[model samples]
Target chain A: MKRTDVTARLLPKLVKASASAEQFAPSNIALCKYWGKRDAELNLPINASLSVSLDYLGTHTRLIPIEGQVDEVWLNGQQLQPGARFSRKVSAFIDLFRRDQTLCFKVETRNNIPTAAGLASSASGFAALTLALNDALALDLPPEALSILARMGSGSACRSLFEGFVEWRMGQREDGLDSHGIPLDASWPGFCIGLVEVDAAEKAVDSRSGMQRTVETAHLYQSWPLQAAADMSKLQQAIQERDFSLLGQTAEQNALSMHATMIASWPPLLYWQPDSVAAMQKVWQLRAQGLELYFTMDAGPNLKLLFQRQDRDVVLQHFPNLETVEPFGSE
Target chain B: MKRTDVTARLLPKLVKASASAEQFAPSNIALCKYWGKRDAELNLPINASLSVSLDYLGTHTRLIPIEGQVDEVWLNGQQLQPGARFSRKVSAFIDLFRRDQTLCFKVETRNNIPTAAGLASSASGFAALTLALNDALALDLPPEALSILARMGSGSACRSLFEGFVEWRMGQREDGLDSHGIPLDASWPGFCIGLVEVDAAEKAVDSRSGMQRTVETAHLYQSWPLQAAADMSKLQQAIQERDFSLLGQTAEQNALSMHATMIASWPPLLYWQPDSVAAMQKVWQLRAQGLELYFTMDAGPNLKLLFQRQDRDVVLQHFPNLETVEPFGSE
Candidate 1:
């Protein structure tokens, strides 16, 4: 096929100019981390993962179609340099929705969560970006379709289309037709997330490349998908039963299991810092002293603590220095 | 039997004082890391591991029998506090040689390696100490017996008794009588080690407690011992065949597999720092450019670069600021 042939075949010929649209998509933390991909091109995960969407931390994306030939991207009040990795990814994502093959995009995104610090900022960013693009182009695709497209930008971004407890099921197909986020709950009462920043600096390894390396080299990575699948069901059952203790314990273990693959990667990737250790120790101590809380971290030194919203005062008291994030519609 | 009665039965009757003796023991780096224990009290490993002893980094110890009721211990020119945890461990280790329960001795030690920065300082220290104690008291214990005693002090310490390639076989006995280091080679020509100090501080989690937690909580730990056993045989074959590439690849993978258990620990014990990641990246880059070297780390933030002695200058060139360690009889 010629250079523009695929675009012509996939995209519409001549469409009227479409107006701009904006959408707010909240960030998410995977209770069961997605560590590796089966197919990198399609962004298919090796295992299923469950996550809780944050009420506050998110990406607000504004999308506009222009007559120009190339997509323009600006993030966090600064225009991304042309040919940058992120700019290229954003451009590629918009390229997917080429209803008007000539419609270039102007994308301005602002994220409340720190980028690449393991808060799944890319998830929220792509989710909102995909949502706004779909709306702006009058595609009116369902949320599941939006999630599948958002996943092309970043694998875990699939979970951000749904609120509360969401599971990204790794579909049983070569083409990944069935894979998408399933909302397990609209809301889980008394659930809260505490963000403990162990280090604010950018990670040495990005989650994508890190997980790819793990999948390629780590021997332990071979055994993780089976356990992760088991954890998905276990976590779902705990959610249905409202078993906080079981849910928290399984979530914590699943996160650690995901990290175990990274740690066994050739050259190894260690994400926890000294303060990350201290915070976990404090959580254990608090649990011993009759508090209900557990912690999970994803590819960064920061720890996201899970607890009951009713115990917010006590939980926040223990982490006086930490920034806290509550679930949507929580007191 | 009662504790005191068993102690009395284990100890020999009073004998005449014996002459003092000195011994030098080298530290070892596990190619296949030992992460868990079958018996905590006996220091029996969950898996067999292969290691290479370093030439320069070791502990030199001298022992002398004395009339005092309590053992006198001095380390690196300073007397360790009597009731400190290390002092107590050393004392208990010496008690195994108690021909006279009231017999006391003076022990002096010096280590070229840092104590707890994952250089296996305790391995070398206790290995030398036990060797010297066995010599001084004229107990004439065989090297295997000495290794067993060394294992009592620190699990991996047993590997330090032998020169060159060593294997600490995780024996199947509960009494741990057969768990000892088997010397694989007196020397292997051209094999060299380059020490890169990522962080020269004591680890937040020591290997013993760290492995204890890993064994208790990490689900992956259950699967590691089997892999470790297979690696042990593969490493021994690589050593026997003198296949540098195969040996290096297996050693590197073994170290990472050991670390995999720690990453799945309840709180997770991460031993790498940012610079550690940098060093590892450099190693991978060097390898892609065709350098014959691999990295293996213990329980701390240092990496041991395995290479050929002829490539010492080239390896040292890559890490000018980092300290390097040469083989015992390298040119």
Candidate 2:
């Protein structure tokens, strides 16, 4: 099914623009990673995933209705050229909302995440863009509808729509209407995430292409759906019970399993740098010494450490430059 | 079936020792790795494996009958204490030969593979020791029988009995008589191996325990037997056809797949250090620029680069300190 058909079915036929709209969406780190796709066109996942939203480190997007024929995209005070990949992607996403009507938008987005952290901004970017579009057009769609829309921009963006613990259910439908993020009620106040920046360089292979290549060439990827399902259940139980050990272990293993598939792929996709291994070894060494620290990695080299508030000082002692974030703390 | 039972069925009922005997055996690198074991006692593999023997980089052993209550073991000019793990293992292997007889021998062995290369000496060590014992006792066993005996000491040691390409067939039987290395008739003269040592430190987990842990804990290991089988066929075909690309691609992919299973295991086995990753990235970058260089890693941080002789200059230029070995060259 086409993305336009899904959007058309959910959105109103006629909508008037509010003067302007602004929205904020937090970035999310998947505890159970979303690796492969069941439907690439609609960004439908092959397996369910769970994540924790970063409280204050995210993206802020402001949308203004414009009279020009083309959408103008600006990021961090710099306007993107129309032919730039980032600008083109934003324009395509905006096109889905302004079908048939001659509507153009001026999009301004700023990410609060530190550049050295090497975190992907697409998750929060798409999520915030979707929310701003909904508000500017006076669509007033529910959270599920907004999440499904954001997912069309980027798969992980669906999880970024919610706060605290969120689960993206891989729905059993061709249209992908049921697949959206749901926020879990449980929250641990002292839960911490330590960002260890290994490298700030651009990735050789983006996650979208990397996921496709792994699904196509990695024979061991056959077992990944089952792994994701098991990890998702474990993560949910850990969150509900506040079991830090279970949470940390499951998250670390889940990330490693995802990376295993990538490494086993043909032409091998390795996103780790030398410093990435050093950081991981440091975490493992500290854990062996009874510090209770575990780490998760995405498609990039940086590591996101999972620990509690009690062990924060010790973790920082080893990783002196670690950027600490309390996911549940008041900003 | 017990290892002793297998040995008893193969060896002669009575044998007299020679005054002294010496032997030499080259080390072998697995193109298709021998990973999981079906029978730990007899060292029977779960799947077939293939390897190429290094021409001169190997082990030399001298065995002399001595009048003593216990055997004395010396390695590289240093006498090993009886209680040391290496000494105990060597003594246990010797005990298998003198079942009912009270025969003692002083054994001295040396490995020519440079210490910094971080290659596992067990394959060459056991193969040389087995050959020397056969000559010392006047057993005069066939190559298959010798390969089978060497396997009981270390699984990959079976392949070290041959000079060029070898295949260790995973025979189906309770006695494991048919499971032995056979030298292939094909030869590729230009084949080269470059050793890139990342770290020479002791591994946190030995291959024996690591393999056991992976088989028990890694769900993805269920797919390994199938992968090995497929890679073994491809490698044999590559050798016969002398297809450099096919040989390099299959070997590299097979090694990565094995590491993938370890990474998917609980408590994740990662042998690649920071420098290992850096070396791998350099290889990939060079390959992208039209240099046909590929790499394979065993259960360690070091990488063994596979290329033809023509590309040696370019490979050496990139890795200045690389230890180059022409596996098929006359030493």
Candidate 3:
């Protein structure tokens, strides 16, 4: 089904625009990653995924109805050219909400993390945009509807709608009404994430194209859905039981399995640099020396380390320049 | 069913040793790798594989009857103690040939390539030993019998028995009689292998244990047998048609797929060092700029680059310290 069709079904035919709206959505790191797409058009995943929001590390978007022919998009205080890729994407997503109406938006979005470095700035960007658009148009939709709308911008954006741990259900229906993010009830105050930035340069292959390539060519991808499903269950159990080891191991394995599929793809998508492997070896070495540490990587060279509050100093000692985050603020 | 059973069925019941015998066998690089085994005892593979012999890069072995209670084993210039791992393994393999006969022999072997660094030294080592034993006992065994005997020592040893392109057929029978190497008639004189040694240290995990761990723990391993079969067909076609691109692409992808399965396993069997990834990036960068160079890695960090003689200069220009070898002698 078309993305427009879903948006049209859920949104009102005629709506009054508010003066302005602002919203903030935290970025999330997937414990069970959302990889291959089941429906590329609607951005439906092949398997369910779970993630934890990075609390304060997120995006803040402000939307205002503009009396112009085209949408003006500004990212991190810099106005983007209308022809720019990021501007085009934002305009296209806004078109879904505007529908037949000739309404233009002045969309200004800002991310706290590095943009397009696989830190998932897009997740919070799209999510905050969705929430801001809902408020700007005076469309008082529920959190599920907002999440579904945000997913149209980027697949992982669905999980950014909620705080703490969230699960994105890969629903059975073709229209994808049921596929939305649900925030988990459990919270671990000691859960910490250490961002080891190997390289903040733009990724050579973006996640969308990479995912498409993996789905098309990788033979090992046949087993990914099963792996993701199993990992999702393990992550859910780990979160519920407050099992740090289970969470760290499952997240690391899931991320590695996802990368394995990419590596097995034609042309071989390896996002890791020499330094990336070095950091991984360091994590493995420290873990061997009785430090409770694990790392997960996305479609870029950077590593997001998983650990507890007690090991923060040790992790920082090894990765001296580590950017540590406590998802549930320090007690 | 067992290594001893296969040897007992193939060899003569009683044999007289000649005065002395010497033989050499080439090391081999698998285009389609033999990964998981169906029978660990008999070294029976779960899938058929193909490889090319490394011309002069191999092992030389000499055997002689001795007046001693136990076999004396020597590698290179140093005599190995009987209790050493290498010596025990050599003695165990020699026992297969001796059967119930109470005979002792002096076994000496030497490898041209680095041992236990994913260079497949054991392949040539066992193959040379098998040939030397056949000559010493005057067995006058056919090439198939010789290959089968070498396989009892190491799985890839079967391929090392032949020069040029060879295929090891993973047979169906429980006895594994059909599982042996066959030399292909086709040869490409310009074919070359460039050994880019990232590390010569003994592998952290040997191929045997790595294969077992992948099979038992990696969920993605379920696709490996099919991948091997498909890659084997492509490689055979490439060899038959003398297509360099096809040969290079198939071999590289097959190797990466094997490593992918290893990476997906629990504890993650990553044989790659930081330098290994750097070398791979260099190859990819060179390929992007219209170079026809491709690389394959085994159970260690070293990369064996595959290219034609025409591109040898360009490959060497990028990798200045590359140890170049013409698998099919330069015409």
Candidate 4:
């Protein structure tokens, strides 16, 4: 109680700070879902996961250097007070940038992608923040090192720094030095993600909390980590071979399996809305009718269809609302 | 070509009926979802399952014994043409009654619950049809014998005949003698089911075909049978002990696990609608706020909440539209 005399009651906000920067990072759709955490301290995932970074949807975060001690945050251009949960989230994320503890950095993050709506905004948001800070602080960290730092902010964020296909390998080391995104491929030229965004009114339970609850309660989750590892290898090979059918099938199964673990958790967490179910059924119907396409969903209602660039017309014919975003590294 | 077989083309709808009877059976919500099949010929489930028959919603079938080559099916008073899929299903079902194959009986079935919407109308439908046929055909079958016969009609239908907690055990024998619903308890006095009905414009893939695909693929489905058996026993004991917390938690987890198996299938079968997800979220939110309740969904969008009668007022407060049904056997 006596310590309040000399010390600040709260952590410092960016009311007054110095260095600042701005950067953009694309969103990623997990072909393999990251459903559980092996280590909560380092934000390490239980299973290795693969994702394709999206070129269309992304987060553009601009760091505004304020002169105050406490860091402020503005998301989607809305001002967030210093001590709020969101501001603290930003400050805590920026604090993960190794060399800075004394100086406060205000982060102004805008998501073209919706935040906390199962759209993987956290992935793009933290990825953008980490990358911007990299240039601003002149960290000179390579993609792998930066991925490790980004993972400290959000598990899926590590995969967003890379352009094309990325894998967040759940390493065995306790220090999490090896737990970082490995760029699987720089190009998936013929494949595109047909993103059907579903605007859910409420935010889902965040991935962190969802994973924690799943790991603690879901008995069926015991076998998922090993299964994901096997799937990751098969998918990587499928990509290398340019086998669209194999790649699409494995990605679809992987996404479903990941959701299964969460769905099996005590009190269950279901991410699919009615529209999501309808969209999935439609995908099945299309494939049954000889359409060479597959679909996967993240933690939210937005569905990503993996189909060839050649079959884009047919896919568009069925899902007129699907926003076609070229796979990362396609441009 | 041979002579045009025009004379046998027309099968009489209701030529000369010897016996007829009408019966009603309530729909059952599977707490432990049955996904795969061990014996398709006998309609045996791949795993043991537990279910609670809903008192509020049911099916009523009127058996019209007809002297014809084939059975005609009239669902909700609409006559289905002979040799159609629905007629064939009815014919095949009635054929399991151990009667002369040449004796065709017309089945007029009506469901208070929606059919094929995942609310398990087939279970109730087949159960009522079988029970009615038992009386009409003068087949003096006990509940166990009738359950086995119902199982041959539809896998889940075996559980619909009994009240309170029921388990459909996947028997050890290949002959399927022991694989029938064993009523765990006759009454759960304090409990009630809050039902939220959702309308689906289209029918999902029926359970039979869905199970076939899931069993053939879905790497995670291999261990579900044994896991389900284990869960069945634990759930049975929980119901016997009247431990609502343990019962509710296990039921919720078991339902999710069953859905997980299907969701992980080759072409994932998701039965939840938007309203289904919303209702489930509401249940989780209620539990978090210290409400003692649990939820489970069948293969459709409709959701059933299990809570004590004492908690009915609060449950109704949140879900004013929820149809409150007392536990079966309470009357």
The prediction achieving the highest DockQ against the true structure is: 3
**Local distance difference test scores for all models:** 0.77, 0.90, 0.90, 0.75
Docking class of 4: acceptable
What tens digits encode model 3's per-residue C-alpha lDDT throughout B159-211?
99999999999999787889999999987999999888777333378899999
Query: Please, what are the lDDT tens digits per residue for candidate 3 over residues A4-76?
Result: 9999889998877755999999999999999999999989999999999999999999988889799999999
Q: Give the docking tier of candidate 1.
A: incorrect
Q: What DockQ does every candidate get?
A: 0.23, 0.71, 0.83, 0.38
Q: Candidate 3, clashing residue pairs? A: none
Cα error, candidate 4, residue B186 (Å): 3.4
Location of the lowest summed lDDT over 10 successive residues in candidate 2 chain B: B197-206
Residue-wise lDDT of candidate 2 within A160-197, one digit each (tens)?
A: 99999999999998989999999999889999998998
For model 4 chain A, where is the 10-residue window of minimal lDDT?
A1-10
Docking class of 2: medium
Q: Tens digit of lDDT per residue, candidate 4, span A43-150?
A: 777788888888768999887655667777888889888888878877866665522346566678888864333476788888999888777666666787778777
What's model 4's lDDT at B173? 64
Per-candidate TM-scores read 0.74, 0.97, 0.98, 0.78
DockQ versus reference, model 4: 0.38
TM-score of each model's chain B: 0.92, 0.98, 0.97, 0.87
Tens digits of per-residue lDDT, candidate 2, B1-331, equal 8888998998987777655889999988899999999999999999899999998999999999999788899999999998888888888898788887888889999999987686789999999999999999999899999999999999999999999999999999889999999999987888999998777344558899889988887767777888888899889889989989999999999899999989988898898888888898888989989999999999889899999998898999998888888888833
Clashing pairs in 2: none
Candidate 3, residue A167: the lDDT equals 98
